[model samples]
Target chain A: QQPVQSPQAVILREGEDAVINCSSSKALYSVHWYRQKHGEAPIFLMILLKGGEQKGHDKISASFNEKKQQSSLYLTASQLSYSGTYFCGPKRGGADGLTFGKGTHLIIQP
Target chain B: EADIYQTPRYLVIGTGKKITLECSQTMGHDKMYWYQQDPGMELHLIHYSYGVNSTEKGDLSSESTVSRIRTEHFPLTLESARPSHTSQYLCASSGSTSGKETQYFGPGTRLLVL
Candidate 1:
C-alpha cells in the first residue's frame, strides 16, 4: 500500500528546520527517503529498516517506528539547496517495488 | 554519479505510434524497475525485473510491456501510444533486497503523445 505523507508542502528559510512524516497502513519492512530537484531524477537520501533503526546524513536524519509503521525525516538548518520534493518509499513484506508517497514539496530561501 | 541511462530524454509522438523507452545500467545490478510520474507528482511503479528473463508487472496496470533480455538492459515498449501514455518514465536499479542498498535512478524519459 502507498504511504501517506503529511504537510504536502513546506517553505523554510536558511538555517531553519523542517520535518516530513510518512505513515503506512500496512507493516513496512523499510522506509526510504529520496529527494528530487526540478527535472531531475529522485536521489536516495536515507533508509530506515524495520528494526527501528535511524540514519543520518549531514544535517538530515530519519527515525523509523516499527510499531506505528511510520517514519520521520528531519532537516536541520535547512539550506537553499534543500529546495526540492521529498518522497517516502515504503517496502512491504517481500515486495519488489517500493510504494511511494504523494511527496512533500519543500522550498528553502536564503 | 549513477551509471543508469535513458535515451531520448524528451519525445513527442502522435497517437497509434509504437514507441520504446530504453534503459541501460552499467552497474550490473540484478534488480531493475520502471516507474511513471507526471510533473510534480508521485511515482507509480509500472514494471520491474529481478534479473534477466524475469519480469513482473507492478502495482499499476500499464499498457506497456517490458523486457529484460540482458542484465544491463531493461526496456519498456508501448504497442500503441496515446495521450494517456504521456509521462516521465524513470528507470532504477538496486544491488540487493537490503533496504540500505540505495536504488540509483536514471534521468528519465519524458514522453508526450498527442
Candidate 2:
C-alpha cells in the first residue's frame, strides 16, 4: 500500500524551517527521502533505516520510527533552491521495491 | 549526477503506436525500476528487475512490458500506446551498502499520446 504524507503543501520564507511527515499502515524497514524539482527527476536526499536511526545531509534531516511506521523529514533554514515536491518511499527490505507517498509540496519563497 | 540515462526525453505520438523507452545505467547496479507519474503526483512502480533476465511486475498494474537482457540495460515497451499512457516515465537504479539503499534516477521521458 502507498504511504500517506501530511501537509500536502507548505510555503515557507527563506531560512525558515519545515517538516514533512510520512506514515504507512504496515511496518517499514526503511524510508527514503527524495526531492523533485519542477520538470526534473526526483533526487535522492536521505535514507533512514530501522532501529530509530536518524539521517541527514546539509540542512535536511530525517527521523525514522520503525515502531510507529512513520518518518519525518526536517528541512532547516530552507532556501529558495529547496523548492520542490518531497517524496517518501517505504520499503520492507533492500530488495523490496519502494512504495512512494503522494508527496509533500514545499515552496520556499525568497 | 547518476550515470543512468533514458532516451527520448519527450515524445508525442499517435495512439496505437508501439514505443520503447530505453534505460541504461553504467553504475552497475543490480536493481533497476520503472515508475510512472502524472504531473505533480505520486510515483507508481510499473516494472523492476533484479538482474539480467530477472523481470518483475510491480504493485501497479501496467500494460507495458520490460526486458532485462543485459545487466546495465533495461527497456520498457508498449505494444499499443493509449492516451492513458501519457505521463512521465522515470528510470531508477539502486545500490545498497551497509543498510544504505540509495537510488539514482534518470532525467525521465515525458510521453504524450495523441
Candidate 3:
C-alpha cells in the first residue's frame, strides 16, 4: 500500500526550513527519498534502512523510524533549488520495488 | 547522475496506435522498473524485471507490457493507445550494496494518447 504524506503542499522562503512526513500502515524495512523538479525526472536523494537511523545529503536529511513505520524528510536552510516535489518510497520487505507516496509539494521562494 | 536513458521524451499519438517506450541503462543494473504517473500525481508501478528474460507485473494494472531481453535494456510496449494511457512513463534501475537498494530514474517519456 502507498504510504501517507502530510502537508500535501508547503511554501517556504529561502533559508527557511521545512519537514515532510511519510507514514505507512505496514511496517517498513527501508525508506527512499527522491526530488523531482517541474518537467524533470525524480532524482535520488537518500535511503534509510530499518535501524531507525538518520541519513543526510547536503542540507537535506531524513530519519527512518521502523517502530513508527514512518519516515520524515528534513530540509534545512532551503534554497530555491530545493523547490520541487519530494516523494518517499517505503518498502516493507522482499525485493527493491518501492511503493511511493503521493508526494509533498515544496515551494521555496527567494 | 543516473546512466539510464529514455527515448521519445514526448509523444503525441492517436488512438489504436502502437508505441514502444525504450529504456536503457549503462550502469548494467540487473533490476529495472517502469512507473506510470499523471501530472502532479503519485507514481504507480506498472512493471518490473529482475534480469534478462524475467519480467513481472506490478501493483498497478497496466495495459502495457514489458520485456527484459538484456541486462541493460528493458522496453515497455502498448499495442493500442487511448486517452487514458496519456501519462508520464518513468524507467528506473536499481543497484544493491550493503543490503541497501537505491533506484536511478531516467528523464521519462510523456505520452499523450489522443
Best by TM-score: 2
Q: Which residue runs does candidate 3 get wrong by more than 4 Å?
A: none
lDDT of 2: 0.94
Candidate 2 per-residue lDDT, tens place, B22-110, comes to: 99999999999999999999999999888999999997999999999999999999999999999999999988788787989999999
- lDDT, residue B25, model 1: 98
- Which structure among the candidates has the greatest lDDT? 2
| Candidate 1 segments exceeding 4 Å error | B97-99
Residue range A19-75, candidate 3, lDDT tens digits:
999999998889999999988899889999978899998899999999999999999
- Residue by residue across A1-110, what tens digits does model 1's lDDT show? 78999889999889999999999999888889999999999999988887788889999999999899999999999989999999999998544888899999999988
Question: Residues B16-109, candidate 3, lDDT per residue (tens digit)?
Answer: 9999999999998989999998999988888988889999888799999999989999999999999999999999999878878889999999
Where does model 2 sit among the CAPRI classes?
Answer: high
Quote the chain B TM-score of every prediction.
0.96, 0.97, 0.98
lDDT of 3 at A47: 93
Model 1 agreement with the true structure over B92-111: per-residue lDDT tens digits: 99886543557899999999
List A-chain TM-scores for all predictions.
Answer: 0.97, 0.97, 0.97
lDDT of each: 0.93, 0.94, 0.93
